[model samples]
Target chain A: MALALDGVSVEVTGATLVRELSLTVESGEVLGLVGPNGSGKSTALRCVYRALRPTTGAVLLDGTDLTALSLRDSARSVAAVAQDNHTELDFTVAEVVALGRFPHHQGGGALSEHDRLLCQEAMRRTDITHLADRGVLSLSGGERQRVLIARALAQQPRVLVLDEPTNHLDVRHQLELLSFVRHCGLTALVALHDLNLAAATCDRLAVLCGGTLVAIGPPADVLTPELVQRVFGVRPTVVTHPHTGVPQLLYTLTGENNP
Target chain B: MTLTKTTADHPPARPTRTGLALPVLALSLTLVVSVVAGVALGPTVVPLPDTLRYLGAALTGGTIGADEVSSYSVIWQVRAPRVLLAAVVGAGLSAIGVAVQAMVRNALADPFILGVSSGASVGASAVVSFGLFAGLGVYALSAAAFLGALAASALVYLVARNRTGVAPLRLVLVGVALAHGFQALMSVIVFFAPFGEAARSVLFWLLGSLGSATWGALPIAGAAVVVAVVVLVRSSWSLDVLAMGDETAASLGVDAEALRRTLFLLTAVVTGALVAVSGAVGFVGLVIPHLVRILAGAGHRGVLTIAPLAGAIFLVWVDLAARSLFAPRELPLGVITALIGVPVFVTLLRRRAYLFGGR
Candidate 1:
């Protein structure tokens, strides 16, 4: 499914958090939304997942307005790993993952064999199969993140919205997670802070600054030194990776900002 | 990776279906035994055989000997209704406790946290002290309390909601604030009562009693509790989804706002019906759900199923102790629950492995 945000704006408590943001992710493409802190990246992603309705305009899935569909219908196509994904209860990892099939079932019925298989496959793919019976509250941060991703995968959604999904991951897991999202072959809109990782994994990058889209294109065109310095307030030395040929940014502490 | 290492070090011990079944079965059986003991062992202790004979005669409409008339009357007319009411109110409180905790997503939340009990208190106080709802005669207090409960819940819902919906924090804060206000209102009503006995009786009602339990009061509270249990058990999965936060619930196609509204109304009505019949019984709603959760994990279906039976058994014994411990001068039901609940809850909290909602 292709997700399109058409002239979407979100204003909360007299402040425009997201301003007329229009963008589209082609079917099965990974679109990275990158911005500095408080640049409305999360707000835009919230709109796609229907966590926050746009003050104006609409979000469309496959050219049909999201509001036109029932909540269950929309959820069948879209799943989210939101930034505020935390549970106070001590649910086992398998139990939490099985909750993804709630929209598929009715009235607290037992999970069918098909639903069980999907949950098992999701846990296996995320390498958290060993932790299936472990209480989620006891797991490490990285393990918990994988469990959440597995839950979203079990939902079997065509469109996935993830906000800061790589926050608590180690370096290797971060790369692995991004790679998994890349090849998962879903229309994913991921809000990320690491421009370098976004450049490496995402097929296209969309940059936001002060609640508006500053640029959207291939990583080579969008992650230029001037744009990085202007948006992120840092000096970067951009270079191609030796093996992958993706742009990587390097910085030094003793730069022009020194007093 | 550390993830793999941690998993290997602590091998998973999956909780099987039989694990839940055994505890549920045990609790159900305990409830039955407790009900029998409740009816038999009161201030006027009837012998076990006579109690059984009375119960069987009443159920089968069989004739009893002339000498056993008073014993049969005591068992059938007085203790039977009181014991059944305790079971119904206990089941309702425990079930609604699970709902309220999940609805607000706070481990400390109880059925009365939404101010319904305090609201009911104000109404009961008005009737006891000021003679409100006088025309209703036998039912005046209950009628007034139910109305007060509904009014207070509506106020809380209105105050806590915004354009988005009722945030859990806002609901808790609003409920606590309004609860205090209602408590003060009840105090004022009690303070201005003309006679000393009126004040004393009002205090008894506030602390709670099942002394007034009769066959007439059973159907309303029993029906409300049954409906609530069925609805809550059906929504168990959604409650789990809702407890994860509104964003996650919305993403999963469970309308968090709509579900919250429904839960608020359902819990409010059920709590009102219960408080109207049994007064403001405490501790069962706050403590039973947590006990069940610790024993049965945090799944709502298991918690809802087992907590009611556990609560029914616990309250049956509590009511027995309430009537017979002081003998001729009955202690309040709330007093016994708190006396027992405080020590048990504190001990549970002191355990190294038990956190309120987590390990």
Candidate 2:
């Protein structure tokens, strides 16, 4: 595992937010974290991203404890694309992407030629190269998400963690973003609210319930109808995509098994 | 989600390099001219030629001849100190303004918004009304004000900071509450003062004045502004990250909590030093940084550099007008700042779509 959460837990004011959660994302794999709302997926991910420290155990990267590294050093290898990053300040798309180079350059000089080239490449990969000069505030929801993703990519991290990156994105953009993430060649840990998307895209899925990890395996093995009913309280008819043979969940609103 | 609200049916206008550079250069030049104008055109109206000669002589450490003595006295002993004080105070307030806005991550925050000014006013009023530090004598008011400013800022920080960090919104709320509390304390002190003359002086002092400019006070304020501006500019990149919110900043390798605490203390110290000498010069700290952002970009590097120069130029002229426009009965500097600043800020808001580096 390139990234491993070793029995990590988070307790805030005596309330267990995440309880002895453990998971691993091997090198060059997309691991999907799925659970119902308030299942502590975000809390567990926060430990990996350094937004919050685990109460008991450690988050290890490449067998080394992440807490042992400086934030700048850790950030150079682990980048995140979070759900709630809104700025009223009008930074240009290129400038926003350039901020990713901050960890690489500690002495605070102007961006090097290589840094500019990296930002340009990241923007191009995220398909926002044309919006380079436009203010990020002027971009649409989908465009802004791409800009943020570009910033994360510019970080050039070995491991990328995204929390609900597709929440505000439309259907086609969502599919395209996930597919892009899959082929981006970086070990990824993605938290998704949509079960079908997690099934279609992720190599494996980790299901969290109330704070503890209940199951972790390939989607076809772990996202069974019984497990879906037990964890999410929704019965999902698992189907195989005719084209890709990936497990695709068909959810029913009206059925004899309703709630 | 295409709630695209365009300011105009035009292209997004990024701040051009030439656009920022030209104005920064012009402002730099204007600041130089304003400093000379501030010294030359004061109440006594020292002749421009003699003012030039005195400045040159002072720079070269050469004593003036007998005939240029009166001009030398006016230029060196009186107007120079006043003008320099105005420039330093202006620069300090403006620099602190930029930092505080970034520190709190609010566009409206200023040096005084943290209750530092009101806290200092209370201390100055205490010295004036009750002679709280009678032993310090001439240095009493400034010392008391500095201590008070530091104390109030510490209180605000303690109240606002949380386990996660000092959230920007919490900081602003706590700062405003403290400011109001300190203002009431100041008013209570002024109301019950035994001497009517002392009360009036405290009122003038609260309104802010550079009338007490002295050779003794100049070095302290000068050193403070220079050091603060240098430190802030050096940390401009960290400040830019901080504005992106605490978690985002932390993920990007900046320690948001530690950085913000350091900035809060730095701003308090700088603001305390300035408020000690100049009482609370308003508008410069609040508006100058925004004005700089509008002309330049919202990046801290440009804003921090331009704010001090713009602020220095602005207050020099304002002070020049304050002293000379009304002759011997000088208007309080804060009154003039608000008078000019409000109309100018309103004009900027109405006229510019690119205010705060947004279009």
Candidate 3:
């Protein structure tokens, strides 16, 4: 699926949160969106997910207008793992995962065996199968993140949108999730704060500053020292990892004006 | 030998569905036990044998003679209606709680938290104290209450909403303001009440009671609650995802506005019917959902299904305690709920953070 935001901009209370920003993601490709807090990365994702309507322009899935699609139809196409996803009600792991199939099941029939099987598979892919019966409220931060990912996977959506999905996750789950998402071969757009993770996981990178897309390209080309210093205000040494061949950033915070 | 649970958790790879039969069996057991036990209780203290005989005759195609008639009349005409009314109110209150909580995403929100109960109370009091609906007879007060509840909720919703529309925060704020406003109106009315005791009667209507549970009221309340329960259970899946919050629900294709509106109306109807009959039954909606969430997890499929059963049982026991606590004198049912709800809520809050999704 091709996900595109065309001249999308949003304003709330007369303050523009997202400027006229446009970006595109090809099917089965991983696009990483990197920006500082409140730089409108989440807002941009919200447009695609329909949490907020763009003040101007539009979001489209394939060639169809997102605003024109019914909420249920859009949901069948997109799955999101957002920042700070907390449950006010405590749901068991299996029950939470089962909610992912909400768009597919019509009422008045038993949940087919296929539905259960898909839920199980998503959980397994996210490595949350063992926590099936455990209550979500009792789980640790990292484990809960995995369960949420499992939920999005259960939706079995063609386009996956993640907003800092690894916020509270351990390093291991972080790598595992990003890597798994890569191999799953879906159209994925992820907002990540960590530059190395962005470089390691995404096929293409889009950098945002003050609600505008400043750079777009491969991770190695887009995450250069000059770009990092300008966007992130940090001077870093860049090197290639011998095994994975992904670019790594080594930052020196000793500068007087360090970021 | 037993195996240890995994320390590093994974998402559940297998979904173990809760079968309808198990929950249904549990509900059946609760229904039978509660009904039988509730019927056996009351201030009149009819002998067990007499109670059984009355029940037996009522169930089977049999009749009782004049010698045992008073006991039969009290049991059938009086005590039976009250017990059944309590059941209906309990089921209805809890079901409404499930709906409101899901719609608003606030555990503190119950059906009456939106000012509908206060509105109904004002309506009933105007009829009773001012003799507005006097000619309408016994059903008049209840009819006024039902309409008042609906009108108040509609008014509050409209008053709070804007071009951007109804957010949970806006709804709660509006409800609180309107509830206090209604209370103030009641207070003003009570100040200049023509008769002294008339005020007391009207105030009692506000404190919440099922004392007026009549045989006629039972069927109406039953039908209303049954309708609400069926609609809720049918949409249980959507309600479950909704509690997970908006971003997730939207990603999964839930039209948040539509679901919220439908649930808001359903809860209002259920709340209107319930308060019209029983006054403002509080805490059942607030407390039962939290209790069910702890036991059944956060799924509305489970929460809505189990809440009504647990609430019915809880209210029956509480009502029993209310009657028996003072023995010869009957205690207000609202007094018992506050006495119980406050202590239990305090205990839960002491160990835990916030209840009702901790928002």
Candidate 4:
């Protein structure tokens, strides 16, 4: 259940999207990948899900090189909730979620009773059971995102990779989703732009800047003002949350007086 | 609002297999009725009972009265082959349409979208205008057309493919460009032909007809269609995954490139075989799959199963109308299909809240 990216680099058309990015998420741990725009958080996550192969290094599942395993085997262990995952055809929510069980039955076999139960369970957990018969095209963005998350949950993968999964979620759903991930007992690597939520949710934060890992540690140790100012080009007032004692950032506009 | 509902209180119901039974049974019965009507109601005015008797005699190898010989020949030898060919080609085109649409991830895509039919047109025109491949005797046109289709498919695959693999957009663009090029080539061949009759025949072939359907030709087209349908039905899940996009397909352990490659080859060959027998029959391939998807869901298994039956029924009637609507002067099958298909397609677009994948 341990997921490791060992010195992974991705170069596309003469541009290096990610460079020597090494990180590891221990079993059942929630690791947050945070960075400014274009810092390669999405690209790094793509490598873990095998959407894009690393140009140099490898992604390992418990010390086994991912590329060495068959794609079905690798997919059986790692499921992804990728950004921009859109479909033109109108599939009902249940049918879309059932696609998560694809690796378990690769030969276009009919879904077993167990597989159907898993799909139903996934939809229930994501609060999308009511939308099971509705077309995905008809859902609101947040609902669609939850449907996708439900699909990943239906995959029953040991390690989950999510890229910007909270893009369209409301505040309550965002908190609920994060809390679910934290307590779900699955090793997860999440890419997030919301630093506060990342701090509140993740056990460890890995910050990337310019396609390289700039910092990696617990939220309190990694979210220092110097690191935030240097990497994100922001002036931050770091404060401890009164309830959870996690580091939270209150940013001020540049060239403005602080109250 | 329903977020707090517990799984224990409301257990999800399993999907019932019988959901598709009624529609499938309805379509199958409709197809059978259409075939009978296709043979009975042609220009010769054969009575329904007589037509049924002829069909029964032919099927069971029973003896017919001597006085009914000519009518029996008209029903069994002429009308039957053409009607069956219409059904087979219709099924094949519909099956390939589903594959092609999923292959390119475009709702507008059809079996001929990859230029295979245009390529077949070029070869068929050459055979008609210049008697090319005459050594193959009766099979010259089909052989030439199949070769041309294969050649065009190879050209498209090679040009569109790169180290990263074939992207759907690139495949479509390359296919459309090559299709136009092949059309131009066919026109050139038609222009240079010495006889006007050759030009007329090529024109008829281009618009499509089941006029030449024979027992000899039926098995080939039927076999090709059967193989293609089986293969496509088996790959139904893969097709659904592939239609979502290559990246999604890859993440789910389906290799998009390999699947596309196999589909391109399969569709090309089957399309070539179909066009070789029936000419470039239009509309059936483009419209039937969407029609099926609207009635059924977008799942490939359901779409594939129903599309073929619907298409067979549609074409059986269309072909009958082509030969009978104008009486002695038979019309091209494509002309009738377009006349019917365009209006229906436009109405579907206008009336339904359907999005071809999305808005």
Tens-place lDDT digits, model 4, residues A55-154: 9999999999999987788889998888877788877788889999999995989999999999999999889998887777777777888888888888
RMSD of candidates 1 onward, in order? 3.2, 2.9, 4.2, 4.5
Q: How many collisions between residues are there in candidate 4? A: 2
Candidate 1 chain B least-lDDT 10 residues: B3-12
Ranking according to lDDT, highest score first: 1, 4, 2, 3
List, for all models, the DockQ compared with the true complex.
0.61, 0.55, 0.42, 0.41
* TM-score-better candidate, 3 vs 4: 4
lDDT of 1 by residue, B219-318 (tens): 9999999999999988999998997789988888888989999999999999999999999899899899988876677788888889888888889999
True contacts kept of each: 0.67, 0.45, 0.64, 0.53
Q: Which candidate is the best by DockQ?
A: 1
* Whole-model lDDT per candidate: 0.89, 0.87, 0.81, 0.89
lDDT of 4 at B204: 89
lDDT of 3 by residue, B225-272 (tens): 889888998888888877777777787777667788888788778888
Chain B alone, TM-score, model 2 = 0.93
* Candidate 4 local lDDT, residue A92: 75
Order of candidate numbers by TM-score, starting with the best: 1, 2, 4, 3
| lDDT for position A164 in model 4 | 86
